[model samples]
Target: MELTVTPAALDCFRQEWAFGDGEHIRVFVRYITEGDPPFAFGITRDTPSDAALTTVAGSLTFFMERKDVWFLQGNRLTIDCLGEDIVFQLL
Candidate 1:
């Protein structure tokens, strides 16, 4: 599985990544909504966990759930901060 973090996304992450000490951005998949895209993404601060698969791009670090790896494979996505929403564009 692979993910692409664009320059715009990286800048946004840098601005919002204010977790203290050892905490970092954790990207997780949630099945909360039943819409066109069945899965929802979440980004939050968390300490490194044994189950998380780690990936780093530029200055940003991402922790993804092992189970979510299959879905993310071959998907190139861009994260853009539009007001209060973090929009993911599939490229």
Candidate 2:
């Protein structure tokens, strides 16, 4: 598994969220019964406890927890900005 954060996204995080270097960002799965995909991904500034995968993009660290591996396995995850919002793409 790999994680990529675009420069635009990094800039958004820095300016909007005040995230600094060495900060830990978590990507996790969220179940939504009303959603088209039935599930969605969410991001947050969090500390690693039982991270199954980790990657560095720019000055920030992005990680997925052990329980979230099922959603991330065998995929390349990219964090990009669409307007002022953060978007997650799995490829």
Candidate number of the best TM-score: 2
> How many clashes show up per model?
0, 0
The model with the greatest lDDT is 2
Worst 10 residues of 1 by lDDT: 15-24
lDDT of 2 by residue, 11-54 (tens): 98888878999999998999978867798889889999999888
Which regions in candidate 1 have their CA more than 4 angstroms from the true location?
A: 16-23, 50-53
Question: What would the per-residue lDDT of candidate 1 be over residues 1-91, giving only the tens digit for each residue?
Answer: 4555666666666665443333467777778768878887777776555543666667556676666655566675556767545676655
> Could you tell me the C-alpha RMSD of candidate 1 in Å?
3.0
Residue pairs in clash, model 2: none
Which ranges in model 2 have alpha carbons more than 4 Å from their true place? none
| CA lDDT, every model vs. true structure | 0.63, 0.88
Q: If scored against the real structure, what TM-score would every candidate get?
A: 0.65, 0.89
